[model samples]
Each structure stands twice: as C-alpha cells, then as structure tokens.
Target: VLESFGSRGQDLSTEELWQKVLQEVTAEELRAPLHRLCALQAGWWLADRRLGSITSLFCLLRQAEDTGRARCSQGENKLLYLLKAWQVPAEEASLPLVQSAEDLKETLCTSAAFLQGLLELEAENFPTAFSLLKEAAGGFCSKRVLAQIYTCLGCCAQRMGKPQTALQHLKQALQVDFQCLPALSHAAAVYHELRETDAELQALALLYEALEKNPPGATSSNPRFLMQTELLVCTPVLASLLRDRHPSEVKYLLAQRCLQDGRVADAVEHYLDVLTLLQEGPQQQVPLVGSSALPRIPEVFLEAASALEQAGRHQDAITVCEEVISRTTDLIPRMLRVEEELELPECPSPGEGLAGLSQKKENLRCLAWRAAGYLHQGWARAVLGESKEAITQFSRCLGDLLRVQLCGSGVGLTENPLPEVEVLQKIRLLSLIGRGTQFLELGKHKEALLDFQHGLQISPGDPAAISYLVLALWKLDRKKEAAAHWLKISQSPPREDEQVGRSFPLYLMSCLQQAVFPHRESLSSRLQDYL
Candidate 1:
C-alpha cells in the first residue's frame, strides 16, 4: 500500500492509495504504514511546504491511537513528539508519557522546546522565545539541529533590539553550518542594521552562493531549496518587503560592491536604477531605516557619471554631467527670482524667513553642483585629448566657483552656507590643474604658470601643481625662477607620499626635457635622479 503511494515509484497518488489501503488494512496493520507516511510528511513540513499531507497523516495516526490498537504505542509516541515540536495544542492527558528508558528522550525534549520557541517567536513574544531557544540550544547534540536553534535565538535577539547579541548567535549558527540560509540571511539584516555595509554584503554574498548551489527542484529535503522556490513563487511579497525597506540604498550598495569587484556594467545599471528612484520624487522615496535623510541626488548622479567614465563610456558620462548641469540651471533662475522677491520692500522679513534662507542655501548648492558638472566635463574632454575644449570647460568651472564664493562673501554670511565648501575647493583645484595642463600643451607657458600659481595658493602642498609650475617657468626662459622653483619642489614633502601620482611628475619632466633640450640627455638624467 505504501509502495502504491509512490514510495517505490507507483503511479497512484498518495490520497488514492491511502483510500484503497483504508478499505483492506485493519487498525493494527495500518499503524506501521501510517507511521511511515507521517515520517515522509514530516520531511515536507520541515521544508515548510505541503502542510496538508502532514495534517492528514497526523489525523490518521491519532485515529489509530484512539482505537486501542495493540502495536500502535510507538506510532502514538511519534505523533505526540511531532505535536510537541510543532507547538500544536495537544491535550496533556492524551500526550504519551516520556519514557525515561528511551535512548532519544533528550533529543525529543530539545526538539519540543525549539519548536515552542519558534511558535512564540512567530507570535512576537521575543523574550520567552529567547529563553526557550537558549535552553533548547544547550541540549542539542546534532550540529544541524543546533544551527536551527541558534538561528531562532538570533532572530529573537534581533527582534528584541539586541543586534550585537543577535550577530553573535548568527555567527555561531554559521560556524555550525556554513550553508545555514536562515542564519546567513539574519546576519545580513543585523549587519545592515548596524550599518556595517561591508559585513552585510559579505553575508549576502554567502546567502546568494548558497541559494545558487541548492536551487529549488534539486531536492525537497534541503530547506534552502524549498525557500528559494517559494520566494520565486511569491515574488510580490519579496517586492513589498524590498519596497518598504529602502531598496534604493541596497541597490546602491550592491552597485558599489560590483564596481569594487570590477563589474562595471552591472554597477552602471544599478546606479541608473538609484537615479530613477530619486527622479521619481518623494512618493517613490523609501525612508532609510534609522536615518533621517535620503542620499543626495546630485552626488549620486555625479558618482554614476564617474563610474561611466571609468568604464570608458565618455559620451555617457558627458550626458549625465549635462543632465546635472541642466537641472542646476533650471533651479538657479527660480532661486534668483526667490532671492529678488525676498529683497523686495513688500517682503518685510527679507532673508529672516526660513523659506528665504533655505532658498538662498539651495541656490548656493545649485551653483556648486554646476561647477562640479563642469569640472567632470572638463576631465572627460581632457581624457579624450581635447585640450582646447578641456581648457574652455575648466575655465567655465572656475568662473562659476568664483561667482559662488563672491555670492557667499556678499551675503554677510561669515560662514559658508552650503555644506559643500570642501567639494567646491576640490572642483576649483581640479579646474586650475586642468587649465594649467592645457595651457602648457598649447605653449602658453606664462598662462600655465599663472594657473599653477593660483592652484599652489589654494593648496600649497600639491605636488602636481608645483611640478607643473617649475616646468612652465623653465619654458619661459626664467632660469633663476625655474631653479628656485626646482629647489622648492625638492624641499617639499616626498612626491611618493602625496596624493598625486608619480606618473604626473615623470610625464611633466619628460615633456620639459624634450621641448627645451632634446639632445641634453645628461641634463635630463640629472633631473630624473633628483625626481
């Protein structure tokens, strides 16, 4: 009859075979076969699928026990054991007495506590769950059972807002079984909550690997396989969870991970998704858990453009930069109008109103973003060897930045209103460096010297600007000035320790040597040795 239920590849369904067996088998004969069926159903229950068969098997076993079958005691004990583990509302009077002589009594007790803990956890009674699960974990002898127990404890700790303890439990669970999906997933959530992005990604990477290795349909016994298939079956639930949890940030982090791993194309796609979510406005915005603000949209767009440039997609980088520029331009006119209106006699408060102050600061931010866009555009042009066009872009960037500085100065705002002062300074320095390099390439040595001098004034320790200044002075026939600059460069901090790379200095020295004295190999060798 069990073979007819497909135990040995019979064609009949379980329900059909069971009905036929019910007609022929007495309660005594049915107990053994029924126990076998319940064991099979229990495996499905562990995998968290097909509860119907498990429920039916439990009912059949209960019927045999109630009918006073002589040999049904073992089957009755098995049913009680499973009920305790499942946290079913079984009558204590009907529960089979724990046989002290049984070899597996401890295991049965541990399993019961673990399942009851899981039930409490499902009901959101975390403290009780924690206590019960902890006790269960102490009694577990099997590594697999212990791993599950620890994972439940971790879940309880996490719910109780004890992330550190939760992480410890999760780590123990993983140590017991590296492929434990529940532990890995919970670890990822805990690390994310702790703002340990790198650790979160590490856990997620392991989880993904486990999912791939134990794909659904490979086997039903592996819980992860069942979970993976269920996740695919109910994608909307997954989507809802992702939507509520600020998936944009997760996508951004994943993009950063992909970029770090040299998966540039994947990073680009993820970055684009982040930008799309931002552009869709506040309704589409998912509030960051434990954070008050979303990521700055302009900064994200700039980063995306940079990633595109790194992937050698120059045109795409330029397009993104142009979008930033256009967006900033559109806001500038509105901000200027607001500023003008605030200055009008009709507005008694002037800049005292919060709205006015906010608009003013936003104007400054837009100007800074515009300058940044130009700086990025200049870099793209420079990388493509368009020196003249690059010079134009750099000049525009410097002009915009100077205007921003002038506006800040005129506002009687002793401090920089925008929190992007450092960013503005970086863009200014890059503009100077780019323009200086272009001027040197165009043989406008004096102009190059002036740009380099301005850059050095902004950042005295900058090696690239200093090296370029020396070359520019030399080309202009200022021998004394060139020698003094060379001495200064030599006395400056070691180039190796500076943020600028050695290649810039090497290239500058090579160009100077070729342009001034191509035949003076001895002089060039001395310069190389000094470098």
Candidate 2:
C-alpha cells in the first residue's frame, strides 16, 4: 500500500495522504517507509510551490524528534539529513534525531546550527548568519553541507560589504567541494567588483566549463535526496546565479570583456560561441537589469561585426551584418513618425500596452539596428575596395535613417533632436564620408567635393572629412584652397581623439585608381612644402 501511494496525484494533499498512511500501515511497517514518504512529499510540495505544506511537514518531523531520538535509526538520520539539505526549517525545539554516538551528536549539533544560519541568512541578518555558519563549520557534516556552510558564510560577508573576506570563505567552499559552481560564481563577481579583469575572466571560464560538464538539473546519483537545482531555485543566491552565471550569458560577458580590453580575436570567438549557443537553445532575452544584463541579440551581432572588422575579416563582418539585417528588417516599420508635443519616452510607459506603444518602441529599435547593419556593411565594402557597392550600401543606410519623420511644424527637431536622432546624425556623417570616398574612387571629384563639404557641415573639423576635402580640392585643380586646407591639417594641434588616422588619406589613395590620381604622393609633398 505504501509503494502504491507513491503514484498518487496532487488531487490528494500530502497531509491527507500522510493521515491515510498512518491509518493503513502498522507502526512497524510505517517506520520502514516513513522517511522515504516524507522526502517524496517534500519534493512534491516544493515543486508545486506549496512551501507552507513543506513547513508543516517539517513541524511534524520535529514533533517526531523525541520518539526518534532514542532509536536514532538510519531512516530518521537520512530524513533529517535531507530536510536540512533542502533548507526545510525545523522549529527551534529539540535537537534532530541522530545515533547516540558522540560523533553523531556532533553532526546533529551541526545540523541545528546550519539550519539556524540559513534562517538568519533568509532574514538578511548577516552577522548572525555568519556566526552560526562559522560555528557549524567546526562540526562533522558531509562535504556538500560543509561547502554550503562556507558558501553561506561567504554570502554573509558579501552582504556585510567585506568582499575580501567573502572571497576567502568562497575559496574555502570550493576547496571543500571542487564542484561548487556557486562559490566560483561569487568569486567571479568579487573579482569583477575589484576590477581584476583577468581573474574575473578566469573564474567565468571555469564556471562555464563546469556548467557544461555537469549542466544544471542533471540527475543526481543520490536519488533519495532532492536535486541540488530543486533546493537552489528557492534561494536568493540562485536568483543571482541564474541572472549572472547562465552559460550563454557567461560567454557573452567573456566576449564583451574581451572586446573592451582589445582582444579582438578572442572576442569574435566568444561572441560566435554565444550566438551558436543561443541558436541551439532557446533565445535568451537580455535581462533588464543594469550593467550585468546581456545585450539584445541584434546588438551582439553588431558587436561581433565590429570584432570581425578589427580582426580584418571584413567579409565575415559583412556576413554578420547581413544576419542582423535579415532578422530585424521585417520587424521594422517602413516609416516611424514622432510628434513634437509628445516627448519620446526612453522606456516603455506602464499605462501603454505592448500591442500599442511598446510595440512601436520595439519597431524603432529594430529600425535603428537594421540601419546599423547597413552602416557596417557599407564600411566593410569600402574597406575591400568595392567602392560602387559600398556607395549603394551607404545609400540604403541613409534611406533607413530618413524613414524617421518628426511630425510638427512648430519648434521642431531642428531645435533639439532626440538622443536617437543625435545618434542618427553620427551615422549619417559616416555614410556621407563613405560615399564621398567611393566617389573619389570613381574619379567623380565634383560629387566627392560636395559630399566632403556637406559632411564637414555636420561635424566641423572632422579629421577624416578634412583630409578627404583636401584631396577633392586638389583633384579639382583648386590648389589655393587645397594648400590652405593642407596648412589647416598641419597647423591644427594633433587631436588625440581623431577618429581617422594620419595615414587614412594615404590608405584612401591606395584604394583609388593610381593612374587617375597620378603622382598624388608627389603632389601632396609639393603642397605641404609650398604651405
């Protein structure tokens, strides 16, 4: 009958089932299956989120402590062990049942202290939790439990704002149980806070490797106990673990950090790994949490493109840009209009439903990302010396930028464009410069001159624009104007923040037909000397 009860569905409450077991099973028979049944029921309650039922069951177990203490059967010990491991609270009553041996008594005391530490941790009483956990660590317990105690102590120290102390406790956790992924995660976070980039990367790499080998939710060898995942899901640390330590998220962080620190090849590799992981698994949305959140998928693709471009894999960069374009183009609106009276909200409005206002905001985001895709593709094509193709791509980028219409006659966008509009201005400047460079490649000096002059209007004294403008004026035989601009470039104190390298004009010259701009190097030298 007890074996049959295992298959019972949730239609019958665990408490009611317990009463039925007591009525049908004799005391001798009950003792055999009692702990097993309780463990099973506790899992069911946890799964259903009926934490109250779990607490009630824990109370019942504490009530039986007096009767079970003298016997100290293996059944009772296993039950107590699992209950504590699951973080099911036993009221501050009699000590949990264990064999009467001195070693067992020490273990029992440790169990009591561990539970109390967890209770204090839950209550956000860090000092008390730390003290209790420290005390618990001195007694005999399973290595898993010892690791958990150290982890809790580390968490307490972290909460108390002692990161160095927290790391020590966390290191002890891993020392006890090398498989303690949570300890590694906390250590990584500490390293990040300390601005130790290499240490943080090392920790993240270890965490990712560990998670891949023994992925979360894997079946445990000890079936009698709940899976570690089942217990962890209920805790606040688990929330942080899921938010900050997910495998794909970890890869993305690795890629982002690599990119920031100028590890272009590594960044591309990590970003590609993240993209592949996302494809094989469910797409992970960027969490809205600040700083630590993963970037949206489109943003990741754009970043990957940047990395690829830096690595001189211009064709691969174009391929990822096309991926972004294909994915987001259908979602973008053909036209996006904003009102002058109503300021554009940077975030979604609570009152505005997703189907209405929020969806509109989403569409705008898609448009901007798609435009970015075009911009990157254009730059890649220009770099590869496909000037005509590059001009077409830049024109497409400009077309997407022009879709945004500011609808109002009065004090309009001219007075103060939105921040998004300001970003669009920068993109527009790049597009003009790129297309102007392409025109120069085709020897259309007049058209190229107009583009460079217009680009200078948008951003005056732009080094790249000024350099190209000098080239265009010389090509049109306006040597006086050309010499004057050449002096401007020489006289202008070198801008450390110049977007274009001093050799950019020389690079542009190499990309064009050498015959059309014959003796360009000699002409440049003569002009510099004449100036």
TM-score of each predicted structure versus truth: 0.50, 0.62
Clashing pairs in 1: none
Best by TM-score: 2
Distance from true position, residue 95, model 2, in Å?
12
True-structure RMSD for candidate 2: 10.4
Residue-by-residue lDDT tens digits, candidate 2, 106-141:
443465456556667778888877887787788666
What is the C-alpha local distance difference test score of each model?
0.60, 0.68
Residue pairs with backbone overlap in model 2? none
Native-to-model Cα distance after best TM-score fit, residue 228 in candidate 2, in Å: 13
